[model samples]
Target: MMTTPIPKTMHAWRKHRGNMEAVWEEIPVPSAPPTGFLVKLIASGVCRSDHNLLTNEKQPSWFQQQFTLGHEGCGTIIEVGDCVPSNCGFKIGDVIALLSVPGCGQDDCPECSRDLPQLCQTGYHSGIGQDGFYAPYATIDVRGAVKVPQGVTPSQAAVATDAVTTAYHAIHRRGEIKENETVFLFGLGGLGFNALQLIRAIGARVIVSDIKQENMDEAKKLGVPEQDLVPVGRSVRKFVEEKGLVGKIDTVADFAGTQETFEDAQYIVRQAGKMLCVGTLNHKNTVHMKIGIRKRLSIIFSYGGQTQDLAKALELIQQGVLNPQVEDGKLYDFPAVLKALEAGNIKGRIALLQG
Candidate 1:
């Protein structure tokens, strides 16, 4: 099969003025930034956050209008910029996943100096605070790209950068979910599903909860047992109590920060139990210090893909240890993808395919 030549203009999903669904447009193919590379995106994962953006809810004021809305993108380099090394371990056709962090703009901020660009005081973010990869090509800092391992597919690697890596960091680093411990996951969305796998991978017994029956069934199908999967509408604290696990759970990871979940997190965890909030839920989650103080509870908010965490997740994907259970994922070209995402019926992931 002959590969098509790069086009001068490419299809992109852009959110125009005001808050609205992303529309397909023949937009200029972005050029490589001064110190970055232009990647020909092979696949990009549609996240739940993308659903929110499409509805014009939870968009940061700084994002403005007319931007792409996917952070989980995997592709290969097609154009290189000036400052990046020509042989910086990335070749013209090497498949890679772009880490979600936006490149720092040569800022003299303290966080940037400390090698923490994600926390740069200037508040930059990819696919949200800036243009992202929902098209054929995306510009990224060469340093922000991690090459996908040989055994990982572009579709799997696309979600790996955020969903998988977020789970790995939350379970292993933040919550310290140890081997032989019990973990309670309070959500069955993409992030929660991956968290279940990661917790299982770490040799922990996991109990997953979701209000949607389909989500509950999917979690069980993804290796969580029927006995362990709890439907969301019921009282979680009562479930923990009836199961005789009031003080037995070592870690509770809440992807859904609902009022009930937070209350349940404190109630279900044992003394000194850790609670990991992997995704933003309900906008502002405020905890009463008095309630947590008595239990010695620890709370942490996990975000982004830490480099080392991403590497380990890639290793798991390569080894078939952790893989997303992508059911009903639609594979589309850029233009069709924009329409599907706007319609808002996609489940699992909507993977955009590039030549």
Candidate 2:
């Protein structure tokens, strides 16, 4: 296999144990694991969750005290490990997108055996409180790497690993949204905007509600009729009532998990309607049991997407069926980019490129 000179150390943006902000420091480059590859990162996408990682005091059990912070990554393989299967098709020069959390694909593993690898507790979670692709170099297991398609750029491929794939998984797998369904979509941020396109692609009618006028306008430009957009600053409940849409919505997909949006979802969706929860703008949201019981709503929460979802999302992007709105920046711009993301100043998503 072709090889490039491996560097001894590279700069990475990491979340320190007590620091409220991310710290950039030089760290030793990692070697490929027995069943993984050492990757030279080309692009890494900044997510709103990155802000949570920086400031949130509580973390999952597997979260490291200090780790690099970037979950969405795309790169070229620089070193292949000995245990990487010969027939798996990955090579030193191949470009691939990394799955942040690829569950152990073991028969004895509960989550993976049930085909929910994204929820696997035993697996390594790249970037989510784990050493990840914020640096020039990182390592990824074979199961977490998906080859980049011909038409997708490195920026697109990077965001596709999470932003697009998560939306795709929620809409298709969890929501099971159909062409005949009328969906009430909440929020038009990174994942929500991508979810809008995915819903549109499925021939579903989507009525979108977002606090940002720019986000709503972007939705309109994506073929959402003006009538389908909730007026900016208007109460979502009031908008639903005004449109005479109460109990008419087949599914309420809440990609902005704010308290208000969660309540609005319960009020608007039809009886027995499905509620697909994908975002967590507010970590804890209340579900009114009386309303839920009376309406018989099905509340479904979705997390990260599987490798197949990423592959399918890439295919859609390649086919021009899904255009992930993203801006490019240098890897060092992570702090500023994340701040802008938290302030809701960024439109869609931002991908940081390696300098």
On lDDT, the leading prediction is: 2
lDDT of 1 by residue, 77-156 (tens): 88778878766887677788887674363557776676555555454466775778787888878657788999898888
Please list all clashing residue pairs in model 2, or write none if there are none: none
Q: Write the per-residue lDDT of candidate 2 for residues 13-108, one digit (tens) a residue.
A: 999988999999988999999999999999999988888888996988988888999999999998888899989989879999999998888999
Best by TM-score: 2
Using all chains and alpha carbons, the TM-scores for the candidates as numbered come to 0.86, 0.94
Clashes of each: 1, 0
lDDT of each: 0.76, 0.92
Cα error of candidate 2 at position 115, Å? 1.7
Model 1, runs deviating above 4 Å: 1-5, 54-65, 102-108, 113-116, 121-124, 231-234, 284-288, 327-345
